[model samples]
Target: MKNKLSKLYKIFLAVGMVFSMCFNTLGMSVVNAYDPSVPKEFTRVKNIKYPEWWGRKIPSIASWSTYSCKYDGKWAFCLEAEKKTPASGKYPAQVIENNENVRKLLYYGFGGPAAYGEFAADADLKTAICPDDPLTNDDIKYLLTHIFLSGAYSGQWKGFDENLFNQTFGSNYGTNIMNIYRRIISLPDPGNGVSWEGNKSGNRALFKASYDKTNKQQVTNTVKLNGASSAEVNIPLASNVTIHIAGTSATQTGGTAKVYGGQSFYFTAPCQNSPSNFVSDNICGNGCERFTALAIHDGGAGTQAQGTWNMDPDDARLYLNIE
Candidate 1:
């Protein structure tokens, strides 16, 4: 009985050794074995390859796909997919191919100087053929501080998150983003404010103005004059208002003209030789100069006239100065 028991013990020990060899050689334990049948959220990219010049690894997921990547030593996920997924409609790509900014990001994050030539070539190709595929906002924030604001791609990567880039590097980068914002604000949008249609030749004018909540200012008041009859416009009280009058031949004439109020105002009128004249009108007190009426003479000549009067602050209506 003792001999039989010893043999059984040896056999069990040999089985244990075989199991240990399998675990050590394969680098996998039974508990950690991979199962092909299980669903996976992401899979490693294989077979397809990118050129060395591409700078960064082409994401393993398909185009328009969503996945996570290590950014700044942390896992960062794409805000949108490269294309439309069932979960999301036509989403933007996380990393655009051949993008100079993206290439710079890769270089600063992982690549080296040897990849610069490839980055430039790929960027040119992508610019000519690809649509804008911007990075996620969070990703942009990370890179803006770590890569862009650090001056890693100063002259090379022009692409940046305007708001974030401006906010982060405005002091050091010379507030270029603020300048861009100012330019955008200065652009005129004719259709944006209150507008009117009237006949200038007929002495008739239509005017409209509304409060602009976004700018915390009065919307631009516009007058369109056509040859018809005498007309007038009354707008609500506003500060530093700008009135634009346009037509073939229009003129300002006499009536209850109020040029002065809380702040100065502007007038754009037609002149004989010049395209138009811009006049600044100020209001000092109750007694202020006012342009009452605009009239077109018998021969289609435009005339602008002004008179002095004390405008009551209680008055809710403001007159139009158009010629």
Candidate 2:
């Protein structure tokens, strides 16, 4: 009787252990299941041809999914997508739009989970600018031209007409426009021989004055010292300003050159003069004349002295820190 009881007890213990193992395995499988609603996989959409206006390549390892949610007491369909790199140095997240009116698709690349939340919140995501409306080719052309010319990153946009831009592009489109510009500007120079520099605003600002070499048609701000042996060029002052002077010679032949407002400051040309008889001395190359800068306080109108200096009006170009 004792032996039979032992056998039965062993059988019961073995069955209990097997049941526990199975339960734990099932729990782990449930916990590890992949949620299709969430973007978990990062596989490329194969054989998809991109549009010219897309401006950026589609990222690898992205997820596209649809969700149905209630909005304003009605069911609405929301599309959510995102992509990210396994490591850094991938493109930053961005939202792209295809505004076909009937079939709208919003592409979210590298935006991650937060972007998905924002996208999901918009029940009528098709109404959002850029994501649904998409930027027109003309809009892109205009923005690129203006940014390259006006130096958008350098607080130049501070003076821009915000109302007109908003009205033209829709609300908050300015930010999207800037984001595209930022991406383009961040790219390598592409051997196009163009370069950019950071402005006081700490943004990479294009040097419009560098690429466009044509002289201003109207020299309104210039103070020309034509054939003046000794004269001070009067500049109407607006606050404290730094004066830029371009001329044929680095140093005055006889008299001294100084800028005077409430106080006087002197500046020497850091570059050499162009070859004699050049049409415009503003060019600071081997055959072109050079310019220099001098700071002046706001006393009233400031004066830049030729001081018995000899140079032609065409031989010099003067500009102030007005804009």
Top candidate on lDDT is: 1
Segments in model 2 whose C-alpha atoms lie over 4 Å from true places:
1-136, 152-155, 158-171, 192-323
lDDT score for residue 138 of model 1 = 32
RMSD of each: 36.6, 34.0
Q: Could you tell me every candidate's TM-score relative to the true structure? A: 0.16, 0.16
- lDDT scores of the candidates, listed in order: 0.27, 0.25
True-vs-predicted CA distance for residue 203, candidate 1, Å: 16
lDDT by residue (tens digit), candidate 1, 67-153: 223222222222112211122111111222222332333332212111232123232323321224344333222322222312322
Q: Candidate 1: misplaced stretches above 4 Å?
A: 1-171, 192-196, 199-223, 226-323
Q: Mind giving the per-residue lDDT tens digits that candidate 2 earns over 1-323?
A: 01122455558658967986898888843221212122221222212211222223222212221121221121211121111112111111111112221011111111111112223333232233234334433232322332222332122332233454455456555565455444444432211111112221111111111111253111112233322122233333222222344443332322323332112222222112211110111211111111111111112223110000011233233332212
- Give the Å shift of residue 28 in candidate 1: 81
Model 1 whole-model lDDT (C-alpha atoms):
0.27
